[model samples]
Target: MKNLLIIILAALLYTIATGNTAAQEMGDKEKMKIFTNWIGRWEGEGSMQMGPGEPRKSKVDERVEAKLDGMVLLVEGVGKAQDASKQEIVVHHALAVLSYDKNTEQYKFRSYLKDGRSTDAWIKPTGENTFQWGFDIPGRGKTRYSIVLDPVKKTWDETGEFSQDGNTWMKFFSMHLTKTE
Candidate 1:
């Protein structure tokens, strides 16, 4: 009876000591750590031009979260602005997902607009906390967005640019956001 109890206690201790080692070994992707500072709720202001129209001012709200056991970063943003009739309306709404592909060793970005448009684009870290992501349209040319994250200041500045020849670029969108949570 004593020997059996000792064996049982030893097995229990071993199990406790090695708890979830497989999961720990296959932990979150190290590359995704670059986006840690961006995981939060943010609010700010922004301006955008539609077609050839003037820029419209809007209030921006963004929420970024890590999901799927840290396999992906999900981002959602909404912009509210006054229309020409002076009525507040949803000017922009977008949701995006960022993930790292271990096999290809590349980052994949998928962004969707409120109007049922979506684009799968390439995304990569440009600097310590800066990243660029974008896709090319069939005929409209190429559109790219760059985001600079200042973790110290908890500020996020993003810009959108378009290029026709993939050389000459024009800026058409921008936003400045501060982390609120």
Candidate 2:
């Protein structure tokens, strides 16, 4: 009976040590579910300041999918607009991967643009249906981006802003999108 008690105590101690690890893994998966609402094909329209000129009208389309068993989000976006001459269609494409970093307790966003520009940003949830992500630009300012999901309206709104003082923000662009899939 003493031997059986010793074996049971050892098993109990092992479970106590390993159970927390399992719980943490489950927590990570649950945290990733915050982005499930964004998984779909979306279409939208917006305007952007391409240069020193006025904001030009643009048509935008995006596709977001949950990959790696819902551990990562893959996003593809395309924007098209008529050039100033109105004789050609200007197109821009961007791809992004968003994933959670368990070690840092933050979401990491990596994006690549057709113009060969790439950026890495840290993401965090700001509201029940909203998340904000961005990075600091040296010598310029900090650029931040946000996405708000409205499930009731089946719509998504995204915006970008720049802050010269890290407090006063100036809006740069915004897009309103409707879920197609």
Candidate 3:
């Protein structure tokens, strides 16, 4: 009788553990579907601060490709000011590679430049197609990044900004991305 009670208790423990593991696995898989539509080619325009009086507005072309490894995505693009002549101004270039975390339901963005420096940020989703992400770098200061996605119209708006105090954010530039084949 004692051995039988021990066996029953062991079986119950095994069942509970298996059930919990299965539930966690399904939750991770469910998260992958939430970010599916963001994978594609897009183009956008926005403004950036060049100096106290010189605010430069530019257009960026980005292509987001989804990798099969754990809901990861890579964003690569180039940006240039609308009115600046290549000879008169230095090139403002950016390359970003980022990944999504299913457990945290967040996106981690890291951007590398030609100068060999990189900036990392954490992105949080606030709405169905909207997200806010920001971070501070050595020289760039505190920056806030936000994105708004319109699935029905297949459009997206993105903004990047810097805050002196980190509480109030000012927009340096905004981009309207339209999906094109």
Cα error, candidate 1, residue 44 (Å): 0.7
Tell me the tens digit of each residue's lDDT in model 1 across 1-181. 9999999999998897787654543553677888888899999999887687778889999999999878799999999998779889998999999988767778899999999999999998898999998899998899999999999999999999999888998998999999999
lDDT by residue (tens digit), candidate 2, 1-181: 9999999999999999899888887788798998889899999897766448778668888999998878889999988887768764747689999988899888889999988999998888898889899998889889988999998898999998989889999888888999999
> Which residue pairs of candidate 2 clash?
none
Clashing pairs for predicted structure model 1, backbone only: none
Model 3's C-alpha root-mean-square deviation from the true structure amounts to: 4.6
- After aligning candidate 2 to the native by TM-score, how far in Å is the CA of 44 from where it should be? 0.9
Ordered by lDDT, highest first, the candidates read 1, 2, 3
Q: What digit string (tens of lDDT, one per residue) describes model 3 on residues 1-181?
A: 9999999999999999999988866676466556666778887665677558866766767777777544566777666653434543324666776665655666678887777978788777788888887787666469887888888888878888887777787777777888874
Model 2 CA deviation exceeding 4 Å by range: 1-22, 50-52, 84-90
lDDT scores for all predictions? 0.90, 0.88, 0.73
In model 1, which regions exceed 4 Å deviation?
1-28, 51-53
- Between 1 and 2, whose lDDT is larger? 1
Q: What is the lDDT of candidate 3?
A: 0.73
Poorly placed runs, candidate 3 (over 4 Å):
1-26, 82-90, 102-106, 138-141
